[model samples]
Every structure is written in C-alpha cells, then in structure tokens.
Target: KLTAVLTYHVVAGKVMAADVRAGKVKTVQGSELTIATAGGVMVDKSKVTKTDIVADNGVIHVIDTVLMPK
Candidate 1:
C-alpha cells in the first residue's frame, strides 16, 4: 500500500515542464494520473508547486497534496 501510493507520484522517463501536456499520464504504480495545464499544472487533485527538479533517474514535480492510487 505504501509502495503503491509512493509510486503513484512517479512517472516514467524524464518529463520536463515544457513537455507537460493536459492529459492522463500513466504512473509507475500502474494507475493513470490526470494532468491539467489550464491556469497551472495539476496532478490529480494536487497543484504542482514546483517543476523540473532533475534527478539521477528522472524528473520530480512537487505537489501540494499526496496522490493515492485508485
């Protein structure tokens, strides 16, 4: 359960802020995450506070809320 929830916040590959699109993106947990780019970037119900934090494996986007897998 913890692993599932944790992986739900992760998306495969290095997705930069410029490449983000308004659509459903598949997470590492096998659940799809809805992305909205209207006023700002949103992952699920959480707002993306930060973007494009480069990591060794992939990029990280900070969200205001915790994403749970359905």
Candidate 2:
C-alpha cells in the first residue's frame, strides 16, 4: 500500500515545467506515470494545478487529485 502510493506520486528525474513533454516517467516503485501537456500537464489521471515548487531535495508539482496505484 505504502509502496504503491509513494510510487504513484513520484517520477524519476527532475522534471521542469518547460521540459515536461508528453511521455511516461518511470517511478521508483517500478511503474510508469503518464504525462500529458496538451492543455496542461497531467500526472496519471490527476491534473497538475501547480508546478516548480522548489524543495531542498527536488521540485514539487501540486496535483489536483491524489494518485492511486493501478
């Protein structure tokens, strides 16, 4: 449960808003997240409401919905 949830929320590499293109990002938990940038960036089924929030270790993207593992 924990692993799924965490992996669902995380994607490998630091992705910036400008650098974000339509693709799949591999998660640490061994799943790939679908990323789309047609109108806006989406992580899985969740829409990214916010982006590029600088953190000490990495950047943060705020999603409108919680990501669940498949």
Candidate 3:
C-alpha cells in the first residue's frame, strides 16, 4: 500500500535537477509520474523544493508534498 506510493516518487538512474524536463517518466513503482518544469519542477501536483542530492546508489529530490499513487 504505502510502499507503492513511496516507490512512485523514485525515478530510475541518477537523474539530476537540470537533466529533468517536462515529460512522463516511469517510476520505480512501475507507475508513470508526470514531470513538469514549466513553472518549476513538479511531480503531479507536488512541487520539487530541492534536487540533486547525490548518493552512493542514486540521487534524492526533495518535494514539498508526498506523492500518492493513483
């Protein structure tokens, strides 16, 4: 239940902030996440506050709101 929602926020590969563009991306949870950079980086209706947090495995992007799978 919750795991699906959590993985829905995760994109495969080490994607950076600048690398992100407006498009539909396949999330780790096997759902499509709508990414829009028109006004700013947005996943669905959630605003991306921070991005490009480098990690050993993958990067982390901080969003103002938590994402829920539909």
Candidate 4:
C-alpha cells in the first residue's frame, strides 16, 4: 500500500524530512527514497503534501505520489 510505503520512508527515530541535510531513507519495501526540497520535502518522486495524521500506532503523511520500492 502507498501508506505503508510512505510509512517505511519514516525512520524509527522520528526524523523530519525538512531537517535532512543530505541523505536517503530506506522504505520497508527496501526502496531508497531520496530526501530533498523542490517545492517542499520530497520522498523520491512523491511530495509530502500533508503531515501528522495520527493513528493509534503511528502517523501518516500524505504524499503526491505512491512510492514503489525499486
């Protein structure tokens, strides 16, 4: 699922993609997501359009595109 793929983009240690200087995040699907700012913080080709959707176990960040592990 896209939600799971985005969730995998998150690190166990609470990291803000905005704070990333330069690095990549590995998704649960084992895909590498490049962190950078075009208009805003982007996960690979997806943009985090919204943030902080709280659930019982974790959070969800809305993205522009569904991320697939390559």
Question: Top model by TM-score, which number?
Answer: 1
**Across residues 1-70, which tens digit of lDDT does each residue of candidate 1 receive?**
8999998888888899999999999988999989999999998789999989888888888999888788
**Candidate 2 minimal-lDDT segment of 10 residues:** 6-15
Model 4 agreement with the true structure over 1-70: per-residue lDDT tens digits: 7776555665554444444544576665566678777567776777788876666665667788766655
Worst 10 residues of 1 by lDDT: 52-61
The models' CA-based lDDT, in order, is 0.91, 0.83, 0.89, 0.65
Clashing pairs in 3: none
Q: lDDT for model 4, on a 0 to 1 scale?
A: 0.65
The weakest ten consecutive residues by lDDT in model 3 span: 5-14
- Per-model RMSD to reference: 0.7, 1.2, 0.9, 3.4
Comparing 2 and 4 by TM-score, which wins? Answer: 2
Best by lDDT: 1
Better of 2 and 3 by lDDT: 3
Kindly provide the TM-score of model 3 when superposed on the true structure, using C-alpha atoms: 0.92
* TM-score to true structure, per model: 0.95, 0.88, 0.92, 0.64
The residue-level lDDT of candidate 3 at 32 comes to 96
Per-residue accuracy of model 3 over 11-58 as CA lDDT, tens digit each: 888899879989899999998988899988988999999888899999
Worst 10 residues of 4 by lDDT: 13-22
Go through the candidates in order and give the clash count of each: 0, 0, 0, 0
lDDT of 3: 0.89
